[model samples]
Target: MGNSTFVFVVFILVYLGMIFGRLPRLALDRTGIVVLGAIALLASGHASLEGGRSGIDVSTILLLFGFMVISAQFRLGGFYSEVSRRIAGLPVSPGALLGAVILVSGVLSALLTNDVVCLAMTPVLGRGCIRRGLNPLPFFLALACAANIGSALTLIGNPQNMLIGQYLNLSFGGYLVFAALPTAVSLLFLQGIVLLLFRGKFLLPMAAKEEPERPFNAWQTAKGGIILCTVVLLFLFTSLPRDLVALGAAGVLLLSRTMASRRTLDTVDWQLLALFLGLFVVNGAFEAAGGLEIMKDGLSRLGMSLASPSRLYGVTTVLSNLVSNVPAVMLLLPLVRDIPGAGYILAVSSTFAGNLLIVGSIANIIVAGEAERMGIPFDWKGHARVGVPVTLASLATGLACMVLI
Candidate 1:
């Protein structure tokens, strides 16, 4: 077969792994699949080893790694867990609690990465619900949905947004100007949909069990918070490169006198970094093989101009669920890279599209997995009941905001 056809085969296999979460009967997960695909392309002589190395976007990797370290600092410091514990301790009804969960998860997610927020908050919220005699399902769903919506609020909120911002050279303040309103409206829509769906159930308090949590470290938490604030200010006010500023912040955190760098680094999601690297190579080779141009022409013939913001929004939302958001964004980037306002459209649409189903985004998967481990039954059906409406409403809000802008 021709080189292009061989690359296409590998791409399809890799995406299948993404959709299934793993390859059947093969202990290979999504990360392993992409790594294998990159290897295959190199071996087939379709892409050289040097070309593959150059394809990996080091700046995106650095920025992602730096943010992961910052997130790790918060996780190790017990910041996320403590915040959730405090919110659950409030003397409020279940509906009020839902609102609090949405607000906290959303706001934190808007500041940090959504996956990290979900990873650190899921167990705390779940156990807190069980301890307070409230059902954990609604709160779990809220954490997942709200995190997805909230992550769209800023450029650094999630990986795909970061890619869009960096690739498009979008101004941090400029993108936020367009994204903030839709994100706020979506958050409100998420809160309302979750509240209306799980009303009264949140009020039934029944005590369950509690999991031992990490000791809250005031100093470490303070350090991470300070660094986070500085990084944000640098991103918003200064003209310095965001990746360099973020790496500097991560470096500062790595210099702790008490906490071992190993401990903080251990909290970093290395597998995710690997997945990004592998996809960069695999997708890069696929693009070099001329697959994207062929697909674009086919779509153009179908009257689908991906350069259009609205059309890009629709395709992004659908493709995100099909192969997960990161890869979908990678596939769509060449099509929309030059379109004005495409960054905001892609960021808001793909990130919010994650709420459509449990398998739609990594944040949802993390929340669901954490809940299941805590003995809470969080099935896809339960997620879809809330996910479907919240996704539709949030996307509607996003579309209206995009139109107004």
Candidate 2:
């Protein structure tokens, strides 16, 4: 086979590995697949070390790293736990709790990445529901769906948004103006779906519950809170590089005298960071092999311009479900050019698609993991009952907004 064909085959295998959650019969994960692909390209003289290094987008890496660090601070400080507890204690009805979960998830997701918010919030939410003698399933589902929907509101909400923002050079405020209404509407749609699907259960009275609480690390929470606020302000006001801002915040958090650097580092998902680096290199090489040009031409032939709202939304939704949103975004990035509303479309469609299936997003997987740890049964069928309809409804709303406004 030609070298191009060989590289293409390897790329397909790597993505397949990602789909199965790891490489077959190997103690390797998605990050490993990406790293292996990059190595294969280099070994076969398809790419060089300099090429690999150049392939990695430092801005994306820095932004991801900064968010991870900021997220770590929240995780360590027990802020998520506090928020969960406060929600649990609200005197409102179970329906209100459902609304609160979706609202909080959406709001926090716009600031922090959806996956991080879900990872930090799920366990606390699960435990809180159980303590209240409430079925944790609906609440947990709300958390997952809300995070996915809410992350669509801003450029920093998900990795796909960051890529779109950087690629399109979108202004933070402009993206928000275009996305905020759609995001809000999507959250309401999600809430309505959750209430209807689980109405019988959500309306039932809860048993008397112990006062819900978790160990609160005030110092850690404060540190995380400050860093998160600073990062937002930086994004809004200063012209400093986004990634550098995130990395610098992470550095400050890591140097905390109260928390060991090792502990802070341990909280960081090194695997996730590696996955980004690996995908960067692999996708970079794929783009260099004329695959991207072929894709652009094919898409153009199909009359699907990435700049078109309806087309972009349709393509992003299908691709997100097909390969998972992150990888799908990486594949589609080459086809997207600087356009007025491309960032909003990319962020909205990619994120909302995550709500379509159990396997659709990393946040869903994290929620599932937490469910398993808590001895809660969570399966694809169960999730799809809420997931599929909510996803479709939100997607329709988002797409309509994109097309109409």
TM-score leader: 1
Model 2 deviation from native, Cα RMSD in Å: 2.5
Q: Evaluate model 2: give its lDDT.
A: 0.81
Candidate 1 lDDT, 214-321, residue by residue in tens:
778999999999999999999999999889989999999999889999998988889888888888888888888888898889998999997777688789888999
lDDT of 2 by residue, 132-244 (tens): 67888899899999998888888888887887777666788777888888889888988888888887875323443344444779888987888888888888887777778
TM-scores of all candidate predictions against the true structure: 0.97, 0.93
lDDT of every model, 2 decimals: 0.86, 0.81
Span of 10 residues, lowest total lDDT, candidate 1: 46-55
RMSD of each: 1.5, 2.5
What lDDT is obtained when candidate 1 is compared to the true structure?
A: 0.86
